[model samples]
Target: MFNEAVTQGDDPGAAAAAHAHGILPSADFCEVVLEEPKADSHGDLSTNMAMQMAKTQRMAPRKIAEALIAHLDDKTGMIAQTEIAGPGFINFFIKPAAWHPVLTAIHDQDGDYGRCDLGKGMRIQIEFVSSNPTGPLHVGHGRGAAVGDSTANILKFCGYDVQKEYYINDSGRQIQTLGLSVYLRGRELIGKTVDFPETCYQGAYIRDLAAELLARDGQELFEKDEAAAIMPCARYAAEKITRGMRADLVDFGVTFDCWFSEQSLYDAGKVAADIRYFREKGLIYENDNALWFKTSDFGDEKDRVVVRQNGQTTYFASDITYHKDKFERGFQKVIDVWGADHHGYIPRMRAAVEACGYRREQFDVLLVQLVNLLRAGQPVAMSTRAGEFVTLADVVKEVGRDAARFIFLTRHYDSPLDFDLELAKQKTNDNPVYYVQYVHARIASIYRKAEANGMDLGGFSTDDLTALSTPEDVALIKALARYPEAVALAGAAMEPHRITYYLMTLAAAFHTYYNRHRVLCEDDLRLTRARLHLITAVQKVIRNGLALLGVSAPDAM
Candidate 1:
């Protein structure tokens, strides 16, 4: 919304450039991008139009910037000053009145202020944390859960028809391993001596499931051969673990529109059909008594086996069918979130998508790197095969849902995260969640104080809005104003960490302003009302952003 001010009122930059050069409007400029300067000394807003025209115009950027500023006069009345900065960057200092409109927008839009129509009505499906239903979700899955759920929320806020989904990997070798694990544990329940294998799951849930199966199925499960009983055990263990995963995700503030079953793909013969289509398209070949996808042709390291010599399909085959099913469901775009270890799968996945008659752009993969759970300063131990990782439920229980989510997303998806458990639980500035939430709580405390002091909370005068002209005040407002742009950028790039970064910046500015200035002064009524309205807007924006990240903006600590 703040960025809209640059183009809506009048041709702010383009008209100025056209008038200066006597060329067509926006003709000489490739693209006029406006952003706040990192340093306050560089003016309020800076654009690179001069550098854009330098190569084509055959002139120094400094000369072009000087020419652009010469034509910018009081025609807009918005720019207070204009100058050419280093390397011919045109920077504009807008009058304080220019930021007043942002307050009106924030007040009027409320919860809807930062929402945009960037995605229009396009349908998008996001699949994340589709971990095989073998054990509880660990902290790695926690990062994916936060990132995926927040990304879906951001896209929906930006007006996309977004569908959040979790694919159940219930039909594979892993599920069979879960069955063997349960089967072995079930015999132990019957007072029979059984040896556990390194390949089988070692989680406590396996013993729990064994107890349940022993009570439900009785000795009947043991009466049948392991081959005949493996299917039932696999089916039962998958359902139990999947239900636990669903419950845990719900508790973590994540929900899915669909709990897609991988077994359903096989039961419906879609996997076979997809293989036939690949065969017909000449995308598959036979080698060493196995069916292989021509993935090497698509820049993969080597050809991949879709069907082994034993006639069982690989996980990649099922994934292709799953994606094909996603596109056939009328989704225009499909996004899958997987761990960074799966980065090598991107090329073949794109190739499969192209073979399914969709462009490469229609499908995307977001690779989430590992999260190193840290207690104090040391690494927390985790053993996936032993089912000994600190579960998402454990993290949520320890730090609260809001703190867990906020800390999980404090870093970008591709970057490795060192999740400091102690810091996440800290109620101090060292904790980002605490810092940002305190800004909101402080604003609420001001409102309570305002009512007690009989201060006007109904409306504020825009004339007094300029009374908040201190550098910290302006910085706080600017941070809040850039929310819409942050949402758009994060959604378009699938980065939820941007929201966390913005919230921290806004919180720091608000904290600085609160410490330095007074919100409800005894002597200055107009200034009091002006700053009250300002902080109220900040509270609204922080809530809006926190809502997207699935975190709470508390009225009090």
Candidate 2:
């Protein structure tokens, strides 16, 4: 793919002369500066080669353009036109013939048409939804789950060996609170007058966990004194909540290759080993009875404590070990998807990674902002402590796995999302997800109708796709041609929202074509056959995209 992009833009002869004269141009620098076909104000493809060369040549941009144009050749594929526009920007207009082969390529490659090997076989691990075991996942965690999972899929498609992981904050004060909450709830169910503390997890899942414990252990856990029962019940509750969380994430079409336990770092001596390594490296120090990392040296707001005065490790400590362990396992890149609330933690984690002798860039943190879930038009307050928040499973049950996953990933992870249940449940065009899936299903319906009438839609396969020349049809084909470029952009940027946006645009084009043109015209057999081929190609592309997002492309409405 890079070769194709390079060959389509390379000006080697120009590069040689420019290099000899110390007048190397921008065109000689980068292989391709892709221009959006729709944003043609920038040209089919545009480069500031002349402008860049002006600095080296000590000449004006117009002179550079003239020199660059002198070396420009017709070898740039599909380039029907090329000229300098606005301050030495070289703009090119591509011919339709240049784009027509992409349709046949789409048909030949089918769903795999847009996939590329851009990652060059690096192993990347994406860890997300490391929500505590104290409660079920709320909408915020759901958004992180969607972003992380979809990102892993995208990277894998782009030739990265990607591992999807969920970090479980299973060992913490939060889980202890959950255990106490369950014990108190069990005591309450047994008619005790114990007061439930404000810090205890008050979610209904805790109550459910308590009931299950009472039924299974026959009140023996509660019969023991508070000290004896607290830790045991806490472990039990954490396990139960973790199970429920795993099930909910699975139902939401998000699966993790690993469920890393924060406790594991301590249990395996990794935490102490990491702290000792830091201490030996002079990065760790004891101050005010707390062990601190010299994170300030690496641009952190302040030095952070690895172990608090109370002798418990801070989240930073656990995270340091977890990240070290990830690198130890040979993952070339460690990607973490976190909510916006943890935006402050990014600097600290990066500092820790750098302090541990690894390049900070090896750790990529994607900050997923909050999701304001709505029922009708009102914001729904998600309370994890009260356990009244909507679970990912609940959302999937309400709108379906496909709709839930697609909607969750419909926006940039760094931007807050408004997930309205009413909008997602709509079966009409107002629902963006269904609009895309409907295009796939509509094409399937047309084929079925053709089969019912004994007309083989597959019987005609010709190279003359020029027969599909309607404005709408051409529009759809053009959209299809951009899929590979779109995937490449999204993968390179680590942005999955681009795929969602691409699907919406592609779906709109298909809907417009469907409404304006008839694919089964009796008198125009050639045109009909060509249009059917185009629609089939569109369907394949849509289905493949939906699969990447973990959404369904149904064959029927």
The most accurate candidate by lDDT is 1
lDDT values of the candidates?
Answer: 0.86, 0.81
Instruction: State in Å the error of residue 331, model 1.
Output: 1.0
- lDDT per residue for candidate 1 within 1-557, as digits (tens), equals 12212221223345555445533233334676987898888899899887887765555777767656654545657887888888988888877777878888999999999999999989999999999988888889999999999999999999999999999988889888888888888888888888899989988889999899999879779556789888798889888888889889999999999989999999999999989989988899888999999877766678889999999999999988999899999999999999999998899899888778888899999999999999988999888877788999999999889998998899989999999899899999999899999989999998898889886555567888889777777777887889999999998898999999999988888888888998888788888889888999999999999999999999999
- Model 1: which residue pairs collide? none
Residue 59 in candidate 1, Cα distance off native in Å: 6.1
Model 1: which ten-residue window has the lowest total lDDT? 1-10
Task: Give candidate 2's error at residue 163 in angstroms.
Answer: 0.7
Q: Against the hidden true structure, what lDDT does model 2 obtain?
A: 0.81
Number of backbone collisions per candidate, in order? Answer: 0, 0
- Model 2 misplaced stretches (Cα beyond 4 Å): 1-34, 37-93, 458-461
Write down the TM-score of every candidate.
0.92, 0.88
